[model samples]
Target: MRRTELFFPRYAWRQPGATRGDERFRRASSLLCSLLLLLLSACSSISPKETAVSKTGESTFKSEPPKKVQAFATPERLKALDTQEAFEYRLGPGDMIGILVWRRPELSQEGILVSPDGFLTVPRIGNIQVLGLSVAEVKALVTSKLEFFYIEPEVTIRVQEFHNNKAFVLGRVSKPGVINFPGKGTLLEALALAGGIPDQNKDTSLTKCAIIRGNDTIIWIDLEDLLRNGNMALNAPVRNNDVIYIPESSDEMVYVLGEVQTPGAIQIRSGMTVLKAVMLAGGLNKNANAEKVFVVRQQTLKGDVIRVDLKKLLESGDFTQNFSLMANDIVYVSPGGMTKFNYAIEKIMPSLQMLNLGFSDLESLGVMERLRSKIWGQSGFINSSSSGATSTTTTTSP
Candidate 1:
């Protein structure tokens, strides 16, 4: 009987359990248990699927697809220049005035400067602060003052040089600087005086031009719309000390990395769309899945995310899908590999390797050609053989 029979007498014993047999059985049983323990230690641990998942599973970063760009259809607020509200011109310190005493030659004055305190001392009119008052108000005040002494007087007040209140024009305009408000001035007149904007001015784009007043007060004006539609309402007038700074259209760049024929930032002009940007990036590589083109646009208010399918737009010419690209947009074309690991490898590494290999092959071929030419002189093998054979024949005949 086996030695294990002695360890558990009833189970192993069809016969009697002797002392030696029992010892052998106990020894065999202990050895078997030790072997099993060692085997268990050497063997790979078998875990429940759930337990394995709990220990080492990771979540992947799947970016949200880009939403179709919606067309902004908000109606423009209409403005009428002719019947619009008359602007109120305010008086300030350091403004020059011309007070004409109509028909009264003795009292007529050509030039008069307002005092630092905003007061103007007129003849026969006790010192009065005309600051912050309109030209009409000043005329009325002077006329009232003259009533005390002279017969019915007619007075006319005119500003010699519009000062104190100023506006600035900068950027792509022919001339950019502080512009004085001659009267209630319109933006059109101001731009014209500044020599008109350059044809290449970025302000001509959809981003439009803006007017800034108090902090956080920005009024965006669509120059193209106003010019095309003749909307006088959008032609808001500039105020005193107002700055009109024009910015160059920023040369935006879109990165077209991963599985693209050319992976780099492309020059993005005004109104450039994703399809156009992709074309600039040299289009998709052979391995690229055209159906999986994505754009990563950074939003001012939201977190960064992957964007829409560009193929549909490109193929169908969907106006809505042709969204205007912002600065620094990243366009990624996916390589349709089955596994994530394969996808990354095909999209990111193999294509670069292929390009390198192609270059290396070209270089090697050039080197081989050079070496072969150096070893074999300018005359090829056939030419050399013929010449040698002729020389031998000539020598033998001679």
Candidate 2:
């Protein structure tokens, strides 16, 4: 019976079958791998790469993406910018006037720092009220008065102080202060006198500078265009009391710290948002908790600290939450586990060291010793490298 069963078992059971199941498994694995590779390739291909100060968050701040200025400028405005006026010297208070009468040397004299009462002291004419009169008018007045003494007094008035005509250049200039005039100076000339700008400086544009007059702030002047492009019109005539502010390039940067693939300061170019800034930081790490992206922004006047959720902004282009960043903004991404504390230590240690150095220096010299410092104490010398007392003492002792 066992021999009969053994012979019968070799029938259909021993027959070779098709490997369809094996083939199906292999095909599914291939498709999944292909899909994964395609996804990776797609990701690899995605190479991610302001004009005036506007009052409101409107189109006024919109820059026409940077193209050559030749193509970007409006023809109408270009024409309007080209007009220049003849230099007309006007007389005002504080102007040092040099009056020269051709024949009458005794009558000719120099007047400086016109009195608060707006009068200039003259020999025979006594105190002449020449404050509001033009140079030509002053000349005529002086000539008419001198005619009593002699025939046809040739009077010529040259200004020295140029008091009324001046510009105030503040903020980020090599020298941020007032630049006075009657050298018939332009905005360019004024800026040059202020040490031209620092190399590590920022400006509205290479050539663009600001001109603030009273309540009005007119911006977007191309200094380079005025110089190189032979666009004399763009070199707008500067007026008295004009405030020119050459603003630093948008300090708007996304500061990356802790566990970032490329952690550093990423500049926030135009149309850039939090998400764009993040991507520029070489995306998040494997352990990065994307949901915990916090933007620490200081509020206006109130000095309130606001935290923004960049994860939500990235998922959805919610620019409202992607608030335009300002200068000195710190963008922080909390790291996984130990990196968070590590980041804090790395950042704070330097600041603490600096503070320590400052305190140590202060402590090294006793309070009594510091107070005993003579010239610095008296002169209110806070920023001098050497104390005035040291020099004076050295001079006296020697």
Candidate 3:
């Protein structure tokens, strides 16, 4: 019998009819492979993102993923973005316009407010529509009209006050409300005016800022790239009524219901997994069918229900069944495998009815307070710090 060995790194193949040495090599290789597999299992079990968000069941809400403006964009796209950055301020209703005729101060007027009808009541030009017109365009119009009264009338027009041309900035910022752009508001400018995004301590890669134009277009920009990396290419021009939403961790939420100790809404943070969410909901109850856990994600009218075996994930460290949760996702653990979705909803309805009848738990109470705060501003607990102590004062919200 001849002794032969084939080897490359951890891999090995045994030739048939070989000697004892070859047999020993085969045994060693098999052990190495087993160890390698165990190592992989250990690494996967310890992975930080072991819990992770995923796909659909239910009515179809057609969701187009947010369009990301890449930080390292092409020169052509950057050029296009640059063109919108230096736009002149447009005049609109309630905007105060100042007009000067160089030497003829008598003909000029200061603090002339544009009427709600978008017309500026100039002394001689009567009411000229300057709502959507830029300052230069309005000045040109005024200058041309004054030409009738003087030779090459030198007219200088400026916006004394900005009452219009507003952008709605909502979400996690120092000031989250309607931000007024003095003139030529860009995406960056709008954010700055709203006191910029607050310091986000979570994973920056997961943080995104969106610009909603009118009712159709949504422009998504990675806040990490724009703010941390100083990516100016993502800064697009903001139009009037454009809504910029930079959601905070508290702003986004997920629902954990059915068979949980304290089933309720949980704020979604970066890397929030199903396992993590379950633990936050005070772990599962004794009656929970951990093998039949369902994640219901609904967008618009369309959605999907994904089933995972939580027992496998938590007990055996089977990472395949555990997935991350997105905003507004519902994690439902059934009491039995044959549980119906409608029946679960019916069970939840009784609790809601009880709340309506002036009966509520701590979970429901906090949720109700948050809902009231959202519907009507300043309707929740207000924290005011005094010397040597912090106090929470509650305010009634209608």
Candidate 4:
């Protein structure tokens, strides 16, 4: 697969005895070349090989491995508590319950659905907070309330529908819907119930996932960590009302900002390379410094800044200079003479400000909430002892 590159040099090469019509023809040729770049043909991989450009303007393939980046900035995923404090399915909104009083069929209620506000309206009792309480807990609460009105009242409550004891698996998955957990649900179990993640050819893939709980807290979970890396730590417990969204590959956009005609964002397509990204952004103008193109990526804290001499690639057909682009990658084609990194960043900042996605900070998952999730569990279980001490299986995210 050949990438059709049409390089129109800033200085037109002409003969000594050139006519006025000859200059017009050269201008016409430049216009035609620029138009051809719009029909770009891209070919690259997701994890591109590291090709570093030296300060002396030479492309060198590094032997060292690529830096390991944490998918989510937070260090650890949530851990489960001991079996003694095992996770019990708690009631939530939309859950249906059946209440029966001993020798009092008239006072009993059947299939009473919990309201969105987490309250259940009973026959005798007006409203009760049934949300986040187990079936055994509900029985105890009902018995106390009935004791005030009736003599030695015995109450038996069972989950009729178990509607709210589920996790929502949304986004680009095979079967996305509410997954019911009869006992306890784990991240892996929910994913399996939702028909697992799908492969969308070479275009877009289900690479990453997130667990959104109360207060819109998002904990980034790497799919690789679960499937390939064997990081069982990522298999967090699925709490009721928890939303697991596995976003498409398009969420990871490639920002093409620089001396290009249409400098903004290009949807990261399959085989998206540096040259293809530049071409898709309406190609470069005459002021574009083809000698020093930069791909500024936010992999780690300091950031991974790689320099690419694109002029050599275009003229000599060198694929080394045209490395692949990953998610959240910034391809900056500087104007002639401005090769310094800081200078290019200064020029690119203003353009980035207009865009919705900011490069200012990494997607930060709060710490205090993590500490809170570590201590207090969904159904008020103390998540103190880990798997080492207890027979705990469900790993959770804080």
Per-residue lDDT tens digits of candidate 2, residues 186-252?
Answer: 7778878788777663323343566665685464566556655877666565766778887565554
State the lDDT of candidate 3 residue by residue for 94-180, as single tens digits.
Answer: 888888888887888999999888998888778888888988899889988888888998888878898778999997778988878
RMSD of 1: 19.9
Compared with the true structure, the alpha-carbon lDDT of candidate 1 equals 0.64
Give the TM-score (vs. native) of candidate 3: 0.49
Strongest candidate by lDDT? 3
- Where is model 4 poorest over a 10-residue stretch in terms of lDDT? 358-367
Cα lDDT tens digits, model 1, 1-398, are: 65543334343223454455344444454454565575456446678665233344564634565444323212343242124377777677778888788788776776688887899878767678998898889999899998887889988898886676667777768888877766776678778878887775443343456566556645566665666668676777677666666556545466777777788877666567777777777877767777777777765435465555766766786657666677677878888665467655766575466545543443333432222333333311211253445211111111
TM-score of each model, paired residue for residue:
0.57, 0.44, 0.49, 0.48
Quote model 4's TM-score: 0.48
Q: Give the TM-score of candidate 1.
A: 0.57
Clash pairs, candidate 4, are 44-271, 78-396, 236-395
- Model 4, 157-221: lDDT tens digits are 88878777688899877999988887678788988899977765446634568888888567777
lDDT of all predictions, in order shown? 0.64, 0.60, 0.71, 0.71
The prediction achieving the highest TM-score against the true structure is: 1
